[model samples]
Target: MRSFFRWLRPYGLVVYWVMLLGLMYLETVNNLPIPTDAEGAAFAQNFENDLSRNVFASLIEITCLYLILRPWSFTQSIGRVVGALVLVLLWTSGLFYVAFNADRISNVLGIHLLWLVVLNLGLVVILIWRVGRLLWRSLQQSRQR
Candidate 1:
């Protein structure tokens, strides 16, 4: 048990951030409007579904930033980067889905959501690139030693 805890120490930050992001995602998703089959419903209803998704994506961006700025065991840092990249990919694909199905997404949230998605995607890409560069530099320095 001690060994397990010791191994997890370097990853504690990532675990905490992931838990916080999950909680935020749950809260936001709970607040989104849900469709009901009521008589004579309007053709379009304000859904705001993507609002939660956008916020979730922002959390991912922040997580990546944290991983890049913090020092950890190399293995733990690599794990954090891989996890963040997977999340970014998932959210980016979801955003694309929303863009392609604009009629449904727009009905839920306004067109501004599309811009928000684009902005988040760009941030994620830049953060990933910067973190990758840092990791490469560190690897090269270790090799030189």
Candidate 2:
């Protein structure tokens, strides 16, 4: 178990957390401040139905995973691959439920929508930190080479 964690990069974990936080921010924005006017409500519903928040969230997850994981080489083990696939599927399912069934979820769970933009802005901070670390390490490796 320790070895498994050692194989993962710190930046990868950071990016994953950023992605999850970003998704939470998106959901919070989508649910908060129930639309009062007909035009605004219609726009919100249309945006949900036409854009498919699940698709956007999935794209962000995939892109972040690729960026964060591509630098490292992993052992081509079947178990690891299968596990990754299962995780991806499960994440997609959860995103779908959250995107489409948020009303029902909030009603049942009594969760309040607190859409603070600062939380979303935090992703930018994470990205900047990760990118700076990546560049510094790359430079160090090149100097050694």
Clashes of 2: 0
lDDT of 1 at 52: 61
**Cα error of candidate 2 at position 56, Å:** 21
Q: Give the per-residue lDDT of model 2 (tens digit) for 26-94.
A: 655665554446545322332333234434544565565445335356433234334444555455455
Clashing pairs in 2: none
Residue 80 shift from truth in candidate 1, angstroms: 0.8
* lDDT score at residue 144, model 2, on the 0-100 scale: 100
Q: Give RMSD to native, each candidate.
A: 9.9, 11.6
Cα lDDT of model 1 by residue, 1-145, tens digit: 9978676655654565555446545545555554555764444444455546544655566566556535354432445555555665666677667667754443323333443454456446645776888889989999999
TM-score of 1: 0.33
- List lDDT for all candidates, in order: 0.54, 0.45
What is the number of backbone collisions in each predicted candidate, taken in the order shown? 2, 0
Ten residues in sequence with the least summed lDDT for candidate 2? 107-116
